[model samples]
Target: MYNPNELLTRFRKYLQAEQLAKSTVEQYCCMTKYFLNYHKCGADRISTSQIISYLVTISSPVSRKQARAAIAKLYFMLGNHQKMNKVPAHVGFYAG
Candidate 1:
């Protein structure tokens, strides 16, 4: 029952319902899809550590931060409140 495409559609609707700006909605959706593809697993199965591990691989600070934000929002929309709460708004990208 872990259909990435279906979850993605719901996520898009959630973002629009939340009244996110069009560009923000697009960015979030794109990042969410990328995350889904990268993990290749159900969103419910993605762990907090997995998310952090992915973020660590992004070389650009801006991109890493954006992806983190997107992941957090996506997790929240997916009802993973614990993981969403754990995703810091500003992860120390400088800290290796």
Candidate 2:
């Protein structure tokens, strides 16, 4: 699992490395931070239930899609070294 700071740092590197647009990077960064704080858990200790809750907070499918894309971005980071994807367990399972 990624800690909040690590997530931010990695996203920063991804933004620069991938040459993502600033606004796009900012949105992903914000989503990453929101997930970190939403769980009330440490960056390293965030749990599946908390992740589900955060996904549930999305009001629309389009919004959820964007959120999932953000997660996939982090997943790429998590998976760089043959690591597992970082997307939470509730991905594609959240009903709302």
Please give the lDDT score at residue 59 for candidate 1: 26
Q: Which ten contiguous residues of candidate 2 have the minimum total lDDT?
A: 87-96
Q: Write the per-residue lDDT of candidate 2 for residues 25-92, one digit (tens) a residue.
A: 87777776676566544444454344544754752232655676666676666553333334344322
Q: Which predicted model would earn the best lDDT?
A: 1
lDDT of 1 by residue, 1-96 (tens): 347777778888998999989987877777766666656543434555566557546423436567777787776765556745343333211201
Off by over 4 Å in 1: 41-62, 84-96
Candidate 2 segments whose C-alpha is farther than 4 A from its true place: 42-62, 80-96
Candidate 2, residue 19: Cα displacement in angstroms equals 1.6
The residue pairs that clash in candidate 1, if any, are none
Model 1: weakest 10-residue lDDT segment is 87-96
What's the lDDT for all of these models?
0.63, 0.58
RMSD of each: 9.0, 7.9
TM-score of each: 0.63, 0.57
